[model samples]
Target chain A: MSAALRLHRADTQPPADLAGEFLARLDRRLHLPQPHRRQVLDELACHLDERVRDLMVTGVTEEQATRRAVEELGDPMVLARRFERAHVAPRRRRIMNMLMVGLASAAALTGAMTLRAPQVTIRSAVYPPPDAVQQVPQKPLDVQGLPPDVQWGDFFSLAASTSGKSPVVHWGALRELDSDNFGPGHSLGIDPLVDQKLTLDQFLELINTEKGFVADNRIEYREEEGRLVFATTHYFDRRETRLVTYDVSELLRARLGGDADNPDRVPGAVHEIADLIRALVESGMWDVNGGSASITTYGTKLFVRVPQRLLPRIEWVLEQAADAHIGAHQGASVDRRQGDPLHTPRDGAALPPAAGSSTVVSVQLQRVDPAAARQILNQAFDGVPSLKQCSVARWITVDASSRTVSVSATQRHAEFVGRLLTMLDRPGADVVASAESSMQVIPLARVSSETMDSLIRAIAGGSTLYGREFRLVANPQQNSVIVEGPTGVVTALQELIALLDTDWEEPAKVGAAIGR
Target chain B: MLHKDAQRDQAELVILSLLDAQGPLYGYAISKEVSGRSDGQLRLTPGVLYPLLKELESEGLISGSVEEVHSDRKEAAPDAAEGRKRKWYRLTARGRKRLAARIEAHRTWRRVIDLFIARDPMDHDQKEHGR
Candidate 1:
């Protein structure tokens, strides 16, 4: 019998005297008769007698000892409580075990041990696409993602793949770290590169080859006129060490309408930019604010990071180019842009760069709500299966078109794209390579805010963003979309817009760089 | 031989009250007292008390000490020699207090009942005569 049940038995009779020993002290926790009490003593007789003998050593009379033992035993209430707690879990386990036993017994009576499996499947969905809006002329086009000012053959000019890669798995789900083999019992995994294992060396090697950089970037102060410009320049680049002289002096002298400040920065490409500024002014597109022109310098590529100022003019030039090339000469479907959130920016015209600098253009919409911006970003991953469910909030996105890198938010989204960058970043995450990918945000609210007037002010100012395009404008009437981009880029942009609209049924949001 | 536990009622009132208050006791310690004074009955049972102790414990209102029961008896039969056991318990404070109060209330009832025995024989007869 369980110890608990025995203690519960009445100690009133049987060895009725012994009953006095345990029962007397037994809390009248339960009221019982002579026989019932005896039953308790019978069960506890051995124990009671042992206690009696123990009291004998305390120097009491034999009878007294037995009685004292009973008295010393104290409260039955305490004993009852004690016994109950000790047995609860065991009792529960026993009940489960007994249930299992009963099931097994019934099974034995029949004789079968087969089990059945469950079924599973995969699913997908897509929304409607949008229409294209009108185009605003572009002055100096945003040529980013096309590889520095160098002439590119095509988008796939540098399509090379590297090997020695490992299949990635989440640390939480690593095979060797299986729960059964975990805890203090297990030692280190035998092979570093086992099924789900990765060695630090192999991981680091992957990062160096794939990630390409491990240094922290710093912002340098350079004097543009008398103003201190907070700009990030890779001063460590080996090429910056050499002070090479080119015919920049002669070019600056011939091109400048006024005195030049810095002489050292001039030379090869600076001379070419000086010549270009003269051409834009002659064409009358330069917007002169007071006596100064908004001159910004940055590399020109399909996804280049142009300075924040010239984005308006650059957007304008791209629009003009696209207007000229798209539809008519570029053909009906040639340089189409996915008019996802296409609109003309309200900013002044493009102007000449500072004396000797190659002008870099940039555009940005200020106070972009993180949520709206995120929703807009979601447009990029719409069709891709893995990224369809990816959180726009948590993805490390690089807008090759805008030259801006926004950090991904972590927890909110669970799509494969959620971990894409993080997994590709540090040594642990085995990202094979890093490349530029451009995407347009949908919904003006998704880019800036649903608040219209402020969004307009934000676009025109152009000072809010680092490298952003003009403000996005929507003609609630025609459902049109207009954007500034090279004719080909604009065409592609239109296709992207159409894909979104056709897939999502959203009206076109056109973007261009108009006068401030 | 079994007449040993006759004082159980007397001792029980006190013990139950303590159990009611403190709730659930270990074997040997339950044989000792935490609160409440002893009656003249020399009734302390470490051995036999354990089994019955174990019994009432199973009935639930009270639980028992789980930490291995150690026998502090320096000299013990091998059957009982799992030395130096300590007992613990889980008691609803309500149960202990109630038990403790019940013991006191029961004693008061017993004292009232005793008044009948102390009454004059004639009065006792007349009291029952109301029937």
Candidate 2:
């Protein structure tokens, strides 16, 4: 017999009744398998024995040592309850094992189907009402009898047909312009010559020449931030640039997995943001001069050119977006006067006097302009709920002339003073903005080659992007797995692998948490 | 002062750090080391330590195996037979990396907090008065 069995059978001095009682209670409460249950009890017994020996060495009696040891281990019922919650019952595992095997392949096909189905239905819903659509005037051209140098007024028109007759090109209004008059319906007088077919590019060139605005329209297909991005830049003002970037990485990864029918199609959420931007522009909300924006899958960050007069509308829109639970951040300004130092806040004058004399704080932000300094103060105060409750705007004054922000409040508001000073000294935007794409190769220890291969198969079967976006290569030389992909996906995969390697880990929890 | 939840969260880090510093150790040794290192400020009961040990073992961060204690190798305990077996746990490569990451995060947090604490307003006010 083993030493553990011999000790149990010997039964000397009633075997510490406190420990025996605790073990009996734990054994009854525990839901672990028979082998695991025995192991746990033996470990607990060993721990108790060690504690008792240590305590007795310190001059404690046998009974006293046993009692103290049992007490230090804590209530057996609580430990048992925690262990029960942590253990995965064998029956539950059996059921999950069966379900995963059947659903693995089906999930891949269904996941792909669901991804491509709703996009078409959601496209129309993304557009604004009919009234919001800008209207362009339409005119037909007559080619039978016409003077060579005819005066075409506000609208450009040409008569053309695909049949073997002289194709007269008729130019219709491209799009309606609500405010800037930059959209369409501007005049383009052409020099009349022998009537021939004119290509679309030729017509666009003519319009570009006639209009002072440079028609810098460009479309690009590229990958950004782990998602495929199709960008179209329409330049209305040479001084301003607008980036209405949409993050559809998640939506794409979710929908276009496992033999998706149309993997190249754009996601619905991207289309929605594009449509919203167009509606906003038509509604005369594109009042800023030079601006750009990045609308991510979950967050929206915008940089708007706000004239002094249009600040109220921008504030109102921001408030509305906040109420809707939309993540929006106000980025750089597009004011031409401040264009010399791009991305930095505009400078301000000297500091103003405080309202109260109880406390006075004057902070100088070295390189930042007054307007930007004020914005930074507002955002910092807004970040902390307690400071935001009292409203930082009421007590603090920003001075552009001396480049100093003075805060005067009562003695009780000294906390605000401390927080504001810390903000001035905290890390700048440059430190916060640097994010590098990380690539790592983690060696799998004690995990069999077959298990790793099975994992690779499951992932590739579930997600269609396995070969393209995300690549998992097994390096036998290093006895490790090299996962190379976008930082987010690779990190997620690494976490999943760690979870899988855990012996007592709940496979269901790991499966459910992983997107694939 | 750490709350119960905060202490529980730091349990994994403490265990991994101990394993990295002292090599393989059993459950009781790990618990005792934690209490001793914290100068009795952080006391980990069996209820907390055992569950955390099991979790870390399951997470692939640490590997555990049973080691037999023979009379020839070390002093045999008086209570039981000559030979006894105890499970000992050692940190895997992943466990070491995890410990390093958590330590780095704690260091960064401490640095930020120190910056705020060091910039005492009263000191600034006194300096202005002196000027």
Candidate 3:
């Protein structure tokens, strides 16, 4: 007989009641098999032996000491239950919940297709962007002319089919002289600034030659936080003297102390701003196109060419100069400008205030602008409820501040809370069905892998999320696996909110209270 | 000759005795069917107050779990922790079934001697002890 069995041979087995409870708990916590549960107990026999030795020190017989040690430890069932309850706290539930919601929302908008790629180190592995090729595809193609359904690529929330003809590229828009005339048209170009020093006349003509680069046309300006935003439909043609024209708002914004509602009236100021930009580019005082600039006005009427790129070489040097005296920023005559509306119409008609308008909360799924970031939660969630309605926005923010990845949820009611009671039982990557009716936060484990895939795909296929570039990723991120892909600010922020919500979890009552 | 209450007074002792002599006792096998032999006076509750057994164990006395069960639920779980969960608790090599069984042994003797008195023992007590 084995030494272990032989040693246990003299001992009577535990009652089925005690044994059964111990086995069940081991399975749930360690994901061990029943036979495996026996091993755990077997391993504890050594602990039992040491405990018996301690009892023996008190002069008890060896057998009596061991028996006393095992007895004092209590039934294995009670111990198992105690360990399980202690190891898993409620906080982990919150993390998992947030991860699910954030991922779900991204999935909903991104065709719910999980993309997997090896973890590519940002510093070590670099690939030129997919569309970085200089040579363009077949041109003069009309994409909209084709049937609307011929879709390719995996951005489910948004779809695109460009006519090999004129490209309708518009990620950013600026300058609306007349909202009526300014439909949703966007024009951009990427001609590097200096070919050779030219008089003021040459610069104007260089910009005019490019498609839609003229003064009356609209051009995009950078946000307060400057991001390197590459635009489409813009091409560069290297020519004699290489003339390039870009919006000079960044450079001019600096000239005007940050805000230039208008920039045309101050004639002499315009000339000076233009001259300064010319000098900076010619002297190579700025990085090749890195002095970062935008088109702006000196004041209400003084048009000033400006650089908007963060950390421009030119701006740094200028600041260092003892006499950083450039031209004086002057107040020009005013020209009243039209302003955009407080709330743009959605669903074609302006959205009427529904009942419980005060309770109508909007959470941002994607950032429209800073002001929109603070929009009503209901309005924000109007189209993207898969994420925001559970309202983990605040919760998600809080968690990220405290921990790295956390397992959490935003359950609304108690019955819904039952969905999670079983999570302790599930092992491996699971898409647990969490909740069906947004009314109660009843969570269910994934009906199956296939079911989860279809659900995610169905939701994701319908959304028009932004910045979904195709790349490979690690396993939890692949088909039917949990994955995290690089997302644009709009999607990233939503995820951040989802992360924040899951930490300190709530029961289903939260949703019920609000829904009621 | 055995005293009338020899076995009844120390049931835990008798159980520990049975377990000590014969490796272990399942819940059903312990403390029963031997009742008639115990002068028809000894009775053990399987369903109620089983807690006494556990209380005895808390003091480092006796212990068990239903390990080594043959049921389908038991066979599937291959881990020993699981099997031990199925296996019942038995005495370690050092336990005397009664930690210091001498104490329980004396209590049994006292109870057995007491059984000698008549039911309305006022007559016997004055008669026996007064002598």
Task: TM-score chain B for all models.
Answer: 0.50, 0.73, 0.49
The sequence of per-residue lDDT tens digits that candidate 1 reaches over residues A1-516 is: 212222324433223244343444453443345544444434343445555566677887556665554555555645433333333333432233223323333344444343332111111111111113322221222223333322211111211101212222222222222344222223322212223232332333332222222222222223223232222233322112221111223333333313233443333224234223322322122222122223333221122122223334344333332222111321112222422121222321322212221112122223343334444445444423333343243323334444333442211121122222221122311111222222122222111121222323332242122233322333221123333322233333333343233211011110011110
| CAPRI-style quality class for the chain A–B interface of candidate 2 | incorrect
Backbone-clash count (model 1): 145
lDDT of 2 by residue, A1-516 (tens): 233233233334343555666676677656677866776776777787787778879998877887788788776656765564334332332222222222332333344122222221111111121123322222233433445544332122332221112322112222221123322243222333226344433443443433322223332112223332222223223212322222334333343344223533333323333323322332232332123332333332233332222333333333332233112211111122421211212432223333433445555656556566566556534543333444445556766776666655433343234233433333344423433223345544333222454554443343322123555655432334555455555565565454333211111222233321
List chain A TM-scores, every candidate, in order.
0.16, 0.23, 0.19
lDDT by residue for model 3 (A195-266), tens: 334322333243333222433232321111222111221211000012123233333444544343353423
TM-score, model 2 to reference: 0.36
Candidate 2 chain A worst ten-residue window by lDDT: A121-130
- How accurate locally is residue A453 in candidate 1, as Cα lDDT from 0 to 100? 22
Best by DockQ: 2
Output the worst ten-in-a-row residue range by lDDT, candidate 1 chain A: A505-514
After aligning candidate 3 to the native by TM-score, how far in Å is the CA of B54 from where it should be? 24
DockQ of 3: 0.01
TM-score of chain B of 2: 0.73
Tell me the lDDT of candidate 1. 0.33
Model 3: docking quality category: incorrect
Number of the predicted model whose TM-score against the real structure is largest: 2
> What is the model-wide C-alpha lDDT for candidate 2?
0.46
Off by over 4 Å in 3: A1-35, A80-516, B1-131
